[model samples]
Target chain A: MEKPKHKLLSFAYFLESSKVYNKIKKFVYDLIENDEYKYKRYFDIFMIFVILSSVTLLVMDVKRHIPHWLDDFDLYFVTTIFVVEYLLRMWVYSDIHKIIIDEYEESSYFDKEVSYYSLFTNIAKNKWAYMVSFSAIIDLIAILPSYRGLRVLRVFVLFRAFKMLRYTKSLTGFLYVLKNKKFELMTLLTLSTFFIFIAGIMLYVFEGDNENPNIHNLFDAFYWALITISTVGYGDIAPVTPEGRIVTMLIIFTGIGLISFVTSIIVSSFNERLSVLREDRVVQEVGKKKKLTVVCGYGLLGRLVVKGLQKEGVEFVIIDRSEEMAAVAYNDGYHAICADATKGTIFEKLGIDDRISHVLCLTSDDIQNAFISVNVKSLNSEVYVTARCSDQEIATKMEYAHVDQVIMPEEVAGMMGAVYAGEPVAFEVLLSIIEEKEKTHINEIAIAEGSFLDNKMIGEVDFERLRLILLGVFKRSEESKLGEFIFNPSDEFVLNAGDNLVCIGYSTAVANLKRKM
Target chain B: MQIQKDILLFGYGTFGRQLYKNLRSRGHKVKVVVGLDDYVEVESDSGVDITRINIKRNDDILALNVNAAESIFYCAMNKTANNLFLVLTLKSLYPQANVIANSNSNETTRKLKYAGATSVIDLYEATSRRIVNVLTKPAVSMALDEIVYKQNDLQMLEIELKENTFLEGKYVSEIKFRQMGIILIAIIDKELGYELVFTDHRINHKLDAGDILVIVAKKENISKFQEMLKKG
Candidate 1:
């Protein structure tokens, strides 16, 4: 019997469904961190979508604004889906005991207590949760008191469609404004309400007589005071007495200060959110996604290697055990996973056993490389491995492990020392230039078989016109005997078909050479 | 003694307090630090005794300013703008001082180095160095690189399930091979984490997109596993 196609498609479906949940989580984080009223813009957009969808569903269900029909089934179906969603959220929360106690055993007591707070904050944090949560509330609003007689609330479900606007950038900006200035605005609101109350009471006493029709009771006085403070003078309520007129004049001047205070609060709030939004957008745009390359130990030598890789535009992931060092890397916009590399669990967590292409072991200890080389080969034999060793013994052992390359740091260092001693002027000149100007880097290009230089000799290649200096030629010929160091040879030294020419010059010079060639 | 190429100083205290410690670490030659204080003392690595020196005089500054060993790092943390002013003023007074200051921005690196830093090294680059360090020593597999494993006698197998299949009960050790190979490491069983470590043995663990199996054998043995799914 053939296996069910659904069973085969289950994994893909599972991933596809989880994508929505992941997107929701990302949206929430963006919402919390968003500085602008981008949330509000998103909310507006989602609401529009919701409204349109609702209208279509309603039109399909009712056909006419009359009583029930077969079309009414669509409204019931959508409402039923929403109801199931609400139940699932509550059901997911029911497993809270297992989720917190089982999953978060290492968490502190305060973290456990605040874990509940995380749920609520998470609602405010994500775009979908923030939207769907409000939508969920609206869903409840539409579903409860399920009597056909109450049609108005059901119609309000059409407005609930606007809830989808939670996904848009502007809605996020709006929410950001609300979130950041919540306390300040709350204070301003309390003061405004209190002043309105005081004005209301005083006006009620001062304008008690029937001379002023608008200021009949305490409620009317509040209405007038609210209008005046808000700078919206409807002129609907006027105080007739001389004392009442003086109070009104005083209230009008207070309006200016109140307005300025509220405006200032909102502008600063908006500015803060706007800046954060821009920063998030930039990070998201710049951060590339590739299978992570886990760098285990970061020391002096490691730093240079990393800098070179970064310059060459390689996407690599880093794992350093040092907390302070990790903080610095993270601050610089590098995704650094902090864990011990020697452990099998870290490699498993990083998904390196399957996805990795190469492993570079450059720790100070040669023994560690020898050991890790074996582990990496055992884990994934197809992966290429390179190790750094100062000890020749360990280097030989590493080679036995099939390490593609073994770099000897001590040997390189000795070579450099000898070079400096023998050619002090050359070494000093290079170091001074690198330190002083930080300009003019080197480019080493190889001559390919198809190139114009296939049969040409050194003197005929127009080296100076290309504005490049041929430092050396790495000849690969059975007839001749030069490997990587054939320097300043005679003009008759033919550029072999597979010879690699090492040229050192600035980037512009290399570009000009390529263009000319 | 060879001059240290790159040295990082954490704090900017009195020149004397930092200078002597640096001198002891660097030996006799002048040392520079970024800070406002001036007390020089050379303490043992044991951190038990302290020797103080009064080098507040102009001679000391001039000596440190010109010494080839002197690479001063400004350690002030409170206000970056103030730190810039202090560093630039010191540079103007002593153009020979190879000044290195803690900076928050790229613009600051340019301005400080231009103002007169022999060369400005970002303390953050130390952070960058840490990342570089990690990259250099990436988590590597031992078996894949070893000579015992690399010879034709050994092979590494990474089997991924394109579709779900029931093959859990069969012993991996008993699996027939097209060529003689050994099943040394099984990654998929461990990747599910500690919960499924050794319990509820159904012998048939269904494979998924994330399911990975690492097997080792001779070169000829791997083709058998590949052929089970009908490759050739």
Candidate 2:
């Protein structure tokens, strides 16, 4: 009785300490860091919106007199939420450190176990680091009391608007672009600075002690130069003499050119960075999917395949050799890689062999198609390969290379033409099947083991009752013969365990049949 | 047979524009169908006034006499569903007209085919094939250069040896390919696969009756080689 009681006590303790600890850790971590978590995303978005609104309100309050009660309510509400967020972030600060340490500890240098005291010390150290971070400082400023008497205290409220940049992906992307183009931007900055300084000095020298009331001192001339060069000419400090006016005109033209140049640079950088971000997003999306098709080539056939896959709501990535084709694919809103598909490293980089279900080598060249087929097969022998061949010779070669399906476009075209000529109605039916014109469509449904329809005679089961038309049955077996398609099978045919029913009907009816089976 | 080849292009995107350019360059009369949202009167680079019809309304589709056009190209934007719907509508209106469509995938190729497209060009496959060919087959590129740029009469021919061919009993080294000014690239044997005969080891081997010699030579020399390989 004492043993059982002790065991129960220990179990309860374990439940209270370890389980609850983990639960709290996960909750806090999700709230603070995990953007992908649904609740966390919503919470973050709500906080961002709140920050934006409060910042806007504060800005307006400074411009004009807002009601006292409204101001107090907004301040208290925003501060309370921010205070709670800050505390939660602080609580999860140790977890973030642990995650970082765990991630890096795989390296030989970091393999030592962090003691409880060291962990506590480390958390404190990280907390200090976090407090000093740009976002953290902004958050603190947003929550801190703004002394009503002090005008400088009101300026801290504007930092809350900068907090929105942390939440918005595009703004972060813009910042990333700025970081990447820092060299060019720095050059532009230094040139503009030099021009402004020279123009200011020239104006100061030309207009000092002049009759013009506005250009009284070097400070005023410097101010005028800035205003004119930025193309924000307020006409406050006009140049009195022709020499001053000509210098001003020259400064204005340089400013216009500089502004345009900077604008163009920023726009181009934004585009480049955005494309990279989009590619990363595509990779992430593909990673989340269980099995995706990797299409090597974004040429005519590859483009068509991507469209078809997209229409069917299938996830796929396109690999193309040409930069132009890859760019086209990317613009078409498909994840694309502009690299040689023949390289085994490309497949490895894409994690194609691990997660890819199918690989379609739709390149027109027979040799390349064969190479891709062989390479993919070597990577993942289980991955289904479908290759397009120009002729029968290439088709034979592809078959010899172990490509599952070798499609000949000319042959298909010829067959399609023959079908069109010989049997128009059949062709129409085929078209209807392919296009899935209406509610009525063809689908392949497998009969699982122990299903009511499994091992039952076709005559015993009434497909008509379910509003399903059985077109054919495919019996898959390991012995004697491989899978055989029994087209328009008689009602007397017995359903096998591994038989697949190829039926035509409304989607609902097919689903109903599947459910019953 | 002399009927005017009036080409109708659906969707004025990249593929459609490319098709229009190719057709216009060949001096074919062509009209483009663009969505009402994107429709704008524009001139081709070659100074051909691009006739763009708005395809937003059913009336717009009806206004364009699709049946009168000799060929219709469905080289629309990347929207396969929209393209499929357009193909279906076009097929329903003019079943006899030769309709060509571009598909992005194999599944869409089937759908386009069944939708009554005379030919469905898989853009990805075609482009990939072209790129691969250009990269791997330098001889093909050279041949293309000769034909397209140089306008030379060079030809690459695959000559199959008959049972009693004049060259059947002789070794590859004794063929006097240098005298013929022809390059024997490889031999495709039925029993054995493609055997590239660059070095003396394979060249010294006796030629078989069923062997196919892949030879690259001038047009005149190809005929001469073919004649020499024929039975007496």
Candidate 3:
């Protein structure tokens, strides 16, 4: 954001500040690289078709006289695509305009001339970094098959197959598993190298002269040793002397031990990463949805809230700190993750975007719930958050954090106990309705504009006919612009558009009433 | 003459103190009893009688006039064992006393129900469920809060129908409770296996004797409705 010296001539800074350029760059980046992009699947599928046909055509070009048109197609049409794709990848690799502007600004601050040479070198350095990256190198080689002089490099056209690594996820997942087991794999590599060298030297010394035709030179002996250690048992090269056979036997046992060690390491690492992969898939799935409810705990209250949400048929994702509880929720057939809710980037990882409508923080710890609510409101102020607190002081803190609702379980329990003590049957009557234990739920039906219920008198809607008990109506007041609850509204209460009618009834009955509206 | 102390609270604890205050604020004549020596000494108020006794024993329970009291609340806070024993002893002795117990968990609620408690409040489940209700059904919860949980004249009163009542032989569709300006939420009848039959049930149930009507209304309206039921 630092202003360049004399903005007009500072073309780099001017380009850097252009919003359209940045947007286009981001669009192309998402199109090619962002896995969570909605349209990337179709893009990848198209590229897979292109890659298969290109490789198949190249393979057949050696013997069968492919039509000249197909050869020209591979040479011109395919190479142009490879070159353009490589360029686009390089362009989105990093912001070269920013690099040049930063270098220019630093040089000006030092009271020196803006050396165009330094800026050029800086831009080149960044481009080189991306060009040497693993995927970029594969991309560069994929274009080499078009050159006639580099016929040896033509064989490297098969390196085009490695370019498929960019499109396929399983290949990258395997690489990630191997990368996580690098330390154990390195140890195994060292142990195998040591044995291969020792066995190669002994084999040449014992069988090089006459006992074995396969062991003429040190290179041949080393190749035999490697094949034996790999447990391939090609048997093309066999040891004849007693000493060589003894070394072969020991190396074979070592080979088995080393192979098993490598397998277990990779398998365990994959097991550890499977949960991560599954969560990533869940996040991707959530990205495609809107108006998702994010439940931030998997405790008793969280379970109850999730159940209510399920009954309401709302889409929701859950996050909890305890792996066991999260696993319990996941096993209960809910999409849940063991993750810290207060982490700044967690919202993005959950793929909530701006579409998260509500967040329910029901963790046992009051401080954690408070922070979770605060974090959610910070990310999206429009999201309604309900947080649980154990005491009044923390409840006030939750309010300051702009939480929509603060639930104090102990205080609510105390009030409930009192209510039960004074009017036992009344408490049961209300609680049965509230808890839905009686198979009846309290629902709010909003009167849509121009609907049958709109602009009608309350008396016109027959309560006995609908078979739904009307509790009250929450009318949106014009002056205050807030919904006010009118308890036990009388028959004179005129039904207006935007009025929310609260009622108690069986779920099916409520749905029936809703259909009428 | 001494005012009738109609309510007895046993095993005073955190929830016990709150319940006592709530009952007192609602104009109920209530007394507290605790077996823990320290709780009795510390929480005992001068004006309110705080009796210290072994509530687990039947003799001590009877000594407190457990059966004579209209309602007995066993609020042992976290001690489920004492609550179970107290409920069992009082039920065994009185055989008809209304015993209400507060349990810390659903498991304890089941045990208390089995031990002959007339009503068992699962504090944990209630707290969690209230939070859930507030979260999932904001508008409905706020409406319920105004009339039910919050302090107001509006009350939920259960009126049982006796024989020869005007509404006894009428079908549910024929009777109009809403004409009295009270919402009849549900009907609990003994012959219906004690399950709450919501007012919105598809079947047009016939109103019979011994059926209790759960109605929500203002205090004066409730009294008016009771008088109308009695006269008609």
Candidate 4:
């Protein structure tokens, strides 16, 4: 019993080192970001405490009912968590080698590039780590004792918490738009500056140097100009003279123009970013899956392919240069890149060299599709490329390029239109057949030692129990090296430990058999 | 007492350097050409006009402190991103400068506007408009746009060399627009890299494709120039 207990402890340690543990850690990290559980509850409680502490501070300041213990308790609770979080983050950063390899390391290839360097420093320097992280920054600012002794920072902290709203899909979509249209927004800000600058100068000249000593110089004038242009006119600074009033009027007019410009930029940027978010979500389901078909075009025909692929969870990348058409794929969370896929440069830029098992060139242009088919072959001969051709003559060209399939969208549309118009039930039956076929498909299973089918003859294995049919036994002779295998062995052949069995069955049946002895 | 406005030209490109000399000679209010990158940084021996920004990011436009000036002429032919980026950033950061800029295209003009450009002018468009004016009303337009005085009977014409025009082979005076009541002011022929004009030195220069000819003429004789241009 002691030996078994010790073995269990060591086995647990072994499990920790495996990819499964890494995957679990990643999922947990994602969960924390989502803030759906433990962190969200903790945050809500902390927020309540902050609010209560602020109320208490206000009451005490006014010489009202004051509880010293409440103040101490709030301070201690906030400080303790802040310290703990800081320490934990530091510890994690110190053990970063165990969690994630450095980017310079070859093994770090799969890891995402961390966008914020400040976050890394907090993890590196254990002191006040949580206080510096984006959310924590807000918290620290909110609790600072400078004005109202740091309670002023709470408003900022609330704003930071509002950013956490990005975790919600809808809010995240909005934020994504904001980030994507950064340049456009920047442009609007730039344009507004000109008006502000001119207005500032006019105010300074007209208002006089003696009255507003702050506006004696251009920088002061500029500061006033920005505030005035932005319409955030703090009454601390005001123009006194009649000339200053005229300048103020000019500044106000310019402010209107600047506001309109900024609004337009944000609106355009929002739409652009939203479209991109929708595209990315489309292909999120097929991550790391194999034997997926990548269809590059998104047209009336492309929709059919997407519907079929989505039903089967088949991995794919959709390449459509048109932003409007690609918006559909984006909404679905599919891997979509906006570029002229017909260009060879796009392939090089996208790094789509040979990783793809299959390619579907379904662009409307027959010549372009044929060109891409040939290009795909040149890039990777083994990739099973299919193309859509408008003309039947292009079929010969597609064949010359060694395309696995040539689908004519017009022909298919005509057939579908006729069938759907004449017999709705027949169309439904066809759809049902496709759905059934996708749900159950042939997959190869590798034989392992001590497995039930390891030494059994093909006929001896109980296929009836599995609700599966033995498609073929792929066997490699002992004399032949790796990568050399014979397909569809005879029924008399005994299944060896190393042999791969190609079986056709429902997914559930295949999964059960794979798990069973 | 006449108070002089001290103007600073930051870039020393064709427009920057030209505006500097042009404004200076006239004596209205012109100072010096300040060159920071490769060009000389002009500052009075006693006075160094400087403005500081307490921000982490370095902006091109704000650094120039153009808003502090009565007028700033920036014709730095630097990277569009570097130039407009700095300009627009400065406009946002400091909104006190009257910035008159030179842009390359319509797209950039739009960008310049958004970046807080007070006034944006395209070099190509300005040159094109000058050419169109000269060709249409050589006498009146040239005196006003180019020569700036009625006494200096100078006019500018930007002509696109036709595929089979006789003047393609001949030099400026040899092909002679004077025969059509036009005086050639300047020939902007890229074949030679620099714009050749009817100056005292380079009067008999050659013409080529994409050459813009700036001509000068009297107000009454400019109509004859149109007839000559239409004939061949």
Candidate rank order under lDDT? 3, 2, 4, 1
Complex DockQ per candidate: 0.02, 0.03, 0.42, 0.00
For model 1, chain A alone compared with the true chain A gives a TM-score of: 0.47
The digit string of per-residue lDDT tens for model 1 on A1-517 reads 1244234235435544577755764565454333342574564454355446555766665654534553354456545654664564443333223333332343443454324455434444443443356545665664542345776665766545544444455576777687788898898888888878877777778886676876667789889888887879898987788987887787777777788998999888877665356435533332333444545556555555566457656566555556555556566676555555666765654456555655666565778777777877777787767677766677788888888767664343222222232222232333322222333333445566667887787768876556554544667767653344454455677886666655434557766655544
Local accuracy of candidate 2 as per-residue lDDT tens digits, A165-189: 7676667777777888899999999
Point to the candidate with the largest lDDT. Answer: 3
DockQ of 3: 0.42
Off by over 4 Å in 1: A1-48, A52-135, A142-148, A151-162, A169-184, A204-209, A213-219, A264-288, A291-311, A314-425, A428-517, B1-232
Poorly placed runs, candidate 2 (over 4 Å):
A1-32, A63-76, A83-137, A144-150, A277-291, A307-319, A326-356, A365-456, A460-472, A475-493, A496-498, A503-517, B1-232
List TM-score per model, in order.
0.40, 0.53, 0.87, 0.37
List, residue by residue over B1-232, the lDDT tens digit for candidate 1. 1233432232323222332343344333323343344332333463422222222334434444343344444333334564566566556666665454545345777876667754443323323322332333221112112211123444333454445333344444344321233332333553355122111122434344435554444455566555554432
Candidate topping DockQ: 3
How far off is residue B205 in model 4, in Å? Answer: 99
| Candidate number 4, chain A TM-score | 0.49
Ranking by DockQ: 3, 2, 1, 4
lDDT of 3 by residue, A1-517 (tens): 2454456347766677789988898888999999878788888887777777789987897898799998898889888888999999899988877886677678878988777677788889889999998789988988998896876877877878888888998789988888888899999999999999999999999999988987789999999999999999899999998999999999999999999999999999999998788777667777777778889988766776787778767788989888888889989998887788998676866645567888888888999999999898888888888888876678898898889988766566666666665555567876777666667777878888899998888888886677788888988777643388887777888988888888887778878877877
In model 3 chain A, which range of ten residues has the least summed lDDT? A1-10
True-vs-predicted CA distance for residue B27, candidate 3, Å: 3.7
